[model samples]
Target: MCPLFSNLFEIMIPKLDPTVIYEIVVIVFLACWFIATVLCQFRETKISWFIRYKIDLFNLIPLWTFFAPHPGKRDYHLLFRDKITETDYSEWQEMEITEERTFWSWLWNPEKRDKKILSDVVQSLVSSIPSFREKTGNLNLLMFSTPYIIVLHAVSQCKKRSQNCYRQFMLAESSGYQKETKPALILLSVFHQI
Candidate 1:
């Protein structure tokens, strides 16, 4: 025998029991379920499509992308500039979105509502861009979309509301956690009067 198996005979190996077989069966079942779930994650994949549409009658297999599908790997930056006039424009200013976390936030968090609302609004708007383009076949007409209108109106309502001033907001993406990455423009809105 090889040196690795020299002690194999010396160690008493227990015979397979009913409990051991049951444990193995459970483990194998779990493993298969995990594999099927992963394979059925993305609808674009041929396997995923077939699995979802063909054999799944009662829809047992969970088509989940684990916990977070598109996790927040980057920071969202909503920057706005005031167009004081047709000829004059103010410097871009960052909209304060993030709030400092407190230990008591877990028990009593009221201020988080505004942050959550802003985040959800932005998320919906960002997600609708591609769908809007495909539906209308014109990017310029995207201004009519509900999400765009909401953000535009919300921004227009913020800070120093007056007839003389106009506001333009842009959504930029960056990795605040990553020092090397730079901010990239995601969406820019037309100037709207306050």
Candidate 2:
């Protein structure tokens, strides 16, 4: 009966090896680290303060390959007013006509495309306006414009989801400028949606 019990125990449970257990632990640790690093780099959700601070510290690692500073889509637009003509161009004509490439399209053909035409136009408008200079002291015009652009994007999305075209146009015009400028040129609002 004792021999039968011993035989059953040996068959049911293999001998445990310390070295094998150590190797498994190392493998599991590496896999977990890799996953954490990937999430830290590319997570869409806002990270907690502690995690962000830890990641910032981890960025000191010279060999670190994962870095996603501004992940996701970034859209920009130009809003200008011609004082001589007393006409406002709320939307950049070029941007209005240009079709946005989908994520799949971009992934399949990852070429250097001329995507910053709107941004360039916005910069030109800012530089041309003397009042803009006074209102924005040494701040890059892009930085000032980004929040407005994001808002416009949100409004456009809301419009699409709710099927409210009037609301879309309303938000486009009424969204205020980041800073009040003298009559030379107002940065106005970014037209993120076509």
Candidate 3:
């Protein structure tokens, strides 16, 4: 027999009691959940805004790649190349309607060309990229949103005014601003009301 198993049997078996095991398990589970909730809430200063803010953890279930800070917004270098701003991001997200349509169509009637599973799998893989450690580095995964939110690094703020016009992607041609013409404009979300 394995030494680990033999040791477990010798030391732990005698103490194992089946009658009260269920109660013990329940107590352990509740304790674990309470601890997790407390930790998530107190992340920033041993007491973070996570708990006070009341975020909907359910909405973040099954993550995706574009769930972090906007790549273009956080990194000035990327934004310079993107040649687009918050307006463009909103437009891009709006354009994603096609993907939704495709998803629905595949849901109703599967087709050979429609590899819907590929998308789900890819997004799931990407969402796993973000971690407590990674947030410290610049490897921001992107959450589909307006460019200005990224530019200002205000993902936490700017919701009331721009709630109506947040998008995930942007089209280069329609964005009205370009990196080549006026790179500075990319940082501003003032083109129009979100």
Which lDDT tens digits does candidate 1 get at residues 103-146?
Answer: 99999988788667766677877787888789888567778877
User: Across residues 1-194, which tens digit of lDDT does each residue of candidate 2 receive?
Assistant: 69999899888866558986888899997886666555555333455333446565655322243333533132343222212222533332222413446678846743324334444444444454565466776434643555445434434543132232222222111112434422232344433333
lDDT of the structure predicted as candidate 1: 0.76
Residue 144 of model 1 has an lDDT of 81
Pairs that collide, model 1: none
Q: Which sections of candidate 1 miss by over 4 Å?
A: 1-67
> Model 3: which residue pairs collide?
42-48, 66-142, 66-143, 67-142, 86-147, 92-169, 92-170, 93-168, 93-169, 165-194
TM-score winner, 1 or 2: 1
Off by over 4 Å in 2: 1-14, 44-194
Candidate 2 Cα lDDT to native: 0.43
Q: Encode model 3's per-residue lDDT on 3-89: one tens digit a residue.
A: 999998978766557757877899997886666555554124434344434553563322233535443221121111121453343
